[model samples]
Target: MMKIHEIRELIKLIDQSTINEFEYEENGAIVKMKKGVDAQVVSTFVPAPVAKQEIIAQPTVTSVATIEKIVEEPKAAEEVAKVEDANLHKITSPMVGTFYSSPSPDAANYVSVGDKVNDSSIVCIVEAMKLFNEIEAEVQGEIVEVLVKDGQLVEFGQPLFLVKA
Candidate 1:
């Protein structure tokens, strides 16, 4: 069974993270939890090495084990690409909204493919409830691809861009 303190620590991590839903099984103990709109969305990016280290070294401190994770194990060949993506950093949406690649329709895009972005770089904008939220790269690396197009409606925690870190 999962310990009460471990469960509490998981809740604390979720409350301050973009992942509203989480599930994990550790030591044969299963746990699942979700959050409402009150979940805090952080705009900072973590590099692959440090992020992976955190996942292994600090299970009780990180948001969830689902960071860029596939819920199921697949046997298809397409999964090879997914395996390759394991080293990439994914900048995800904080809320359900429209994904905009630029500040305005007439302006140039915030960051395109092959563009190098820093921790504070604004990669795109998510328009939710008439408010435009600037989504930051948070990870310093080259933008591998823009997963969503302008005016595209995206869900909360949806992957927006893949960065090669």
Candidate 2:
């Protein structure tokens, strides 16, 4: 069973964050909560409708030990090349975005197959929102494998490149 304080803390986090809903399970109890949104489409002719805030909370208990066990399993690491892979550097995404290898639509890619990169070299670009963030090589090495493709949606901490140092 979840304590009341834990539930309150979850509520506060939802209010502070951009997330509209949150749910969690603890000690055999499941809790579902959501914050209501008030979207008002306004016109120039009349007064806008007042927005009201609503908070909903629901709770239940069920066996979830099997589901939890599956989620806890560690993911298998991807094997890149046949060469000695012990000294390879895993270049991961710094933000949640779409990855692009080139600066512009018609421009050549920053790095290509068999390209050597130092710490300051820009290997790719991660586009989050309207901003294009340059992803640099943190270690000096030859690019062994490009794990992601152009315009691929990448999550935070997702591996984009494997470099054999």
Candidate 3:
């Protein structure tokens, strides 16, 4: 459970910034605050979507952009490299297999670090039962890291690349 003081502190933090969003954890509780209509703040627990409630004061359009900028931090370029460094996205082998970065043993890899890709980008190849399978990117982003080395075995959902969208 979260403490009321922590929630109040979060409100203060949100008010202090140009970014209209802030999230923090205290005492095993995760607290998130988002700017709401009319200078009011909405609070919610983690793993649940935030629900809106009427606020006494309506927020100005300028504040809305500030909030957007804050919420958009996930897409910040600096974090992109962290995602790659952390190997966050796990591209798994759909079938039991050996993973290859290229169509053939002698070819270059399908995708490499810093490659801009869309949801349909073929980032790598997986070999199962002597057949080469094209593994496509499920999300849009730049390739951050390659978790598995070429010619390595991979399991289902095993991380292949970290992408930043």
Candidate 4:
């Protein structure tokens, strides 16, 4: 479980980064943070089974100046591409883990950019707590982009690939 100060620090880091959402989970505890319109910050917490409590924090304005600064920075080319591609389907991580593009070091990648994938196609593997979870494409499409590099730590709901359906 994360302490309140740790969560606040995470929120601050996220506010300063380009990421729009962040999630952390451990031992049945979960914390999620999302940036909303007007620079609002929303947080949700699910405690462990022993606690069995759900806590939702009210939207808070930590630093309006920082938020304004973030808004003023120009979007990069990749960011623009993501925004303009309306037909792209994002394949997101279902759990927090280390992402692997291949089954093993010597094995070929499951999928790559421009590869066609069906609903059951294995796209990647996410290893959490020593368990490798195979992630499927769920949507039939051509993969247009690979969002994360191999062995990167990914959070839940983090975009992993962009597919053109």
Reference-based TM-score of each model: 0.54, 0.52, 0.46, 0.53
Report the C-alpha displacement of residue 2, candidate 3, in angstroms: 71
lDDT of 1 by residue, 1-165 (tens): 777897899899988887778989888877888776665666653423523222233234344554223323233434788786998999999888999999998999999999999999999999997899999999999999888888999887778999999
Off by over 4 Å in 2: 1-83
Question: How many collisions between residues are there in candidate 4?
Answer: 0
Q: What digit string (tens of lDDT, one per residue) describes model 2 on residues 105-142? A: 89999998799999999999999978999999999989
lDDT (Cα, 0-100) at 74 in candidate 2 = 25
Between candidates 1 and 3, the TM-score winner: 1
Q: Extract clashing residue pairs from model 1.
A: 45-138
Candidate 3: misplaced stretches above 4 Å? Answer: 1-88
Q: Global lDDT of each model?
A: 0.83, 0.81, 0.73, 0.86
Ranked by lDDT, the better of candidates 3 and 4 is: 4
- The residue pairs that clash in candidate 2, if any, are none
Q: In candidate 3, where is summed lDDT lowest over 10 consecutive residues?
A: 41-50
**On residues 1-165, what C-alpha lDDT tens digit does candidate 4 reach at each position?**
788898889989999998887878999998888777577665433423545354344335768776655555534544786576877998999888999999999999999999999999999999998999999999998999999999999888888999998
Most accurate candidate by lDDT:
4
Q: Give the Å error, residue 128, model 1.
A: 0.9
**What's the CA RMSD for each of the models?**
21.3, 24.0, 23.5, 20.2
**For model 4, what is the C-alpha lDDT against the true structure?**
0.86
Candidate 4: segments with Cα more than 4 A from true spot: 1-83
